[model samples]
Target chain A: MSYRSIKLIKYPTQEFTPDVFDITTQAIPTPKEGEFLAKLSHLSLDPAMRGWMSPDTESYIPPVTLGDVMRASGIGEVVESKNENFPVGTRVMGLMGLTEYAISSGQGINPIPKELPAEAILSVVALPGVTAYQGLFEVLKPEAGQTIAITAAAGSVGSLVGQMAKNLGLTVVGVAGSQEKCQWLTEELGFDQALNYKDADFAEQLKSVTPNGIDLFFENTGGAAQAPIFERMNAHGRIAVCGLIADYQTDSPAPGPSWLNIIKKRLTIQGFTMPDHIHRFPEYAQALGGMLAKGKLKYRSHVIKGLESATTGLDLLFEGKNTGKLIVEL
Target chain B: MSYRSIKLIKYPTQEFTPDVFDITTQAIPTPKEGEFLAKLSHLSLDPAMRGWMSPDTESYIPPVTLGDVMRASGIGEVVESKNENFPVGTRVMGLMGLTEYAISSGQGINPIPKELPAEAILSVVALPGVTAYQGLFEVLKPEAGQTIAITAAAGSVGSLVGQMAKNLGLTVVGVAGSQEKCQWLTEELGFDQALNYKDADFAEQLKSVTPNGIDLFFENTGGAAQAPIFERMNAHGRIAVCGLIADYQTDSPAPGPSWLNIIKKRLTIQGFTMPDHIHRFPEYAQALGGMLAKGKLKYRSHVIKGLESATTGLDLLFEGKNTGKLIVEL
Candidate 1:
């Protein structure tokens, strides 16, 4: 039998182009002595993938090498196994790459429960959930009654972040790219206020919404909304910079707000990536799963059909076209 | 008997022009009940004065109200006293303002040892010393063998910070505005390397000096050198934003480096003012004093003559003209 896999052909100079990746057919290989071979059911498309495609070796994780399967996290079911831990029919998830089939020794892979749907697993129990949990609880350390402003607020990670903050009694203000996302944040997710960054009077609206000023900032997208939110930060504010999706595609990212406000307000700005805190994934996933089961968290997936769609679908995240978590279902 | 006092008559719109201050003659008042009359001998001129001269109430401390004695820290002798804790002839240091005489209830005052010269006391045991100690040890949390890049390396606070870091076995790179200051940092303060920020190849020099990349950044001056130093920071770098002398005078401060590097390197940048940590002053002062007594700390004072010189002498700090700790002798 034959399965298809996409391989990165070249590193992007600025932004990803279709030519950067090439899909190839491969015959399914049998598992080795201690390995398990699985057929991937779903693939996750995240903003962090942009960093992985670049040639920057200094990043949290090494960039995806050319001529290799494009790196991704996915849900798969074990079809063939030489290992007892991941026997036949066992569902697993990890950085299995963008492929219909994968072989693993269970090094970084985790056997997931069979009950949850693939969309829920990829959206809330995967990278997005764990990242939101870590950034909101650990980095921002939100307090009840504290106002938090999260950028990309309707996206996978950000939506989870806003929901978690709201559940903890924080006044959550979400910043997104479109009015529909903003309405979803406020109406569906119960975010206190949601502002569209594209509005001409966005800064004025931000100031009006956050009368007491922002105490915590969960920065996912570093763009136009950053300066306005930064200016409204109260004294002793803490900022958790989880992602810079807006700047990910450009070689010349915009300069950040002046550090004068940083000093004036005695702010703490910390940047973090999930790879650095990978060891805590299982622990974070459990907490997030509990939140999901208790109905304290709500997640949406912008599912794209087939493995080949992932190449072009990634731009949906960069362009803010995706309504929720960008996922590829094979 | 009368004393000369400089009062803030107007808030500076951008930079400090001489007209903002008024030299007023006042009768030296007798101590009432708990108050003590201090004959100010030496006034410390710091870069923080620029912030105090502004109308921005959002700053760390309340700006000096117009028509009040221009706020400053100084060393003085309690020539007349009503309080037992501050006996007559006792040497003291505190925020006594820009005056030849001050009356105090000894609220924030710290009685100092009569042995140390006013220069050494103000430079190493007062604001500069405690600020440097707090920023280096507490904020940056230096680990031995790590490299630290300190801006305004020849200034009072920066000089002590570099010296303390060097004593802790860290490789120190000092960034200054002048060749003379750079020479002092390397030769006198024992920094591993000192680069003049004005040099055309300053960034290249910084990169060469910090071959392993900067691990800790002591950001004092937010100017042309900031971007270069920020760009060279290594993974998990910690930046302590103590002062921004370069931006204090300008109404429009330059934008800081892109947040992209913050994520790529997982850097933690914190802004702090000494006022917030004032409760720990005595503890920090004692440690810094011990370092000074053991000859582990070296400081030089650029003493200007008379209280009247303070209004103009204050500009030396903003202009980066002061060779050492700027002090006004009465």
Candidate 2:
């Protein structure tokens, strides 16, 4: 049988827009020893995919080179398997992605429930969920009664951060790119306040909402938005920077506010990668999963129709078209 | 009895230059019910004083008012006092002032031993000394066998940070302004290596010394010293921002070299004020005083002659002239 795979056949040198990918059909490979073939149901499209296209090297994984099927995370049903650990009809999710069918050699992939929906194995219930959970409680560690203002608060991780902050009794404020997203942040996600960063009076609105000062800031999109908030930070404030999508796709250097304010406020600004806290996975899945099960957690996703639209789904994130996690269902 | 005391004038806005401060002697009042009086002996001339001169806004404390005597930490003798908690002739070191005398309302001052030379009390035995101790061990928390780099290596806090990091079994690299300071850091202060940041290839030399990347960094000077070190930080590296003296006196905006790299490296950069860790002072003083008394730790100081010369001492710190602590002996 033949399966189609979308690969980044050309190296993107400049801006990471469309027309940089190549999709083709190839015969599905047969499983060897310790291998399994899975039928993909869902795949995650993330802004980090742009970083993969860049020439920067990573420690554990090889850079995604030209003519290679782009790497991604997805969940699928095992149709055939020779490996005893992963039997046929079992389900798994991990870095096995961007295709209708895949043969896994088992580096990082792990088997899960065959009955679980693909959405659970994908965006909000997957890495984005865990990223927000660990980054909020573990990395930022805002105390109860403190105020937290976050960018992209309508997006997956940011939305979860707002909800979790509210649950943990923190005063939550959100900054979104549009009015609708801001509305969603305040009215639906239960954030104490929301600011539309695209508005001209956005800075003023941010000040009005957090007059006492921001005790904790969860930075997802970093750029111009970081300036005014830097000035109004309280003494000993903390900033947890998980993503800087505002400058991710652009090649030009992004200008930032003065570093003096960071020192003046005696801030603790930290950058964290989620898997680094993989040691706390069971705790997170247990705690956040319990929150999810209790209906205390709320998450949303903008899912594109098919694997062919995965690339477009990612671009929407850069344009701020998608409010939450953007996923592609095949 | 006639005693002259200086009070906190209005908050200072300009640099600690000549026109920035005014001196007036007022009759010192007798200690009331819970009050005490101390005759100032030696005053700490610190880079942190520059930050205290910000606009009449909130900081770690209210900005020293315009007409109030300049706020400072000093080792002084209780010349006359009524409070039983602090009797006559006892030497106490605490946040006193630039004035010759201070009358406390039993606020934050603690009376001490008359034996500690005024210079030693103001130098390595007091706030600056305890600052380096707590900042390096408590905030930066360097691990044994790891590499640590400290900026302003010859200054008060930097000198002590180098020694404390060294005592913690870290390979300490200190960056100072002058050749003499560099030599002193390595030869006298137990730093494994020292480099002059004024060198043209200073960044390259730093990279060579910290080949494994900086596991911990004591950031005392921000502007030029911190920019290059940002690129050389290891994953999960911790930076304790003790001070930022390089730009302390500058009115213009300083430079920033895309600290977004802070995220890719997964670093933790935290700025700390000593008073925030005041609860840990007794513990810190015990450890540091023991280290000093045992001859395991050593510190240096640049002394300026009288209260009138304190302005010149402040400029010496800005010019990076004095090695180790800069103090004004009255």
Chain B alone: TM-score in each candidate?
0.99, 0.94
What's the CA error at residue B12 for candidate 2, in Å? 5.0
Q: Model 2 Cα displacement at A56 (Å)?
A: 1.6
Candidate 1 global CA lDDT score: 0.94
Candidate 1, residue A314: the lDDT equals 90
lDDT of 1 by residue, A1-330 (tens): 999999999998987787899999999999999999999999999999999999988888999999999999999999999999999999999999999999999989999999999999999999999999889988999999999999999999999999999999999999999989999999999999999999999999999999999999999999999999999999999999999998999999999999999899999999999888999999999998898899999989999999889989998988999999999999
**For model 1, what is the alpha-carbon lDDT of residue B213?**
96
lDDT of 1 at B123: 90
- Candidate with best TM-score: 1
Candidate 1: which stretches are off by over 4 Å? none
lDDT of 2 by residue, B210-309 (tens): 8788888888888777877877788888988777777677676675556567677788888778877788888887777788888877777778878888
Q: How many residue pairs clash in each candidate?
A: 0, 18
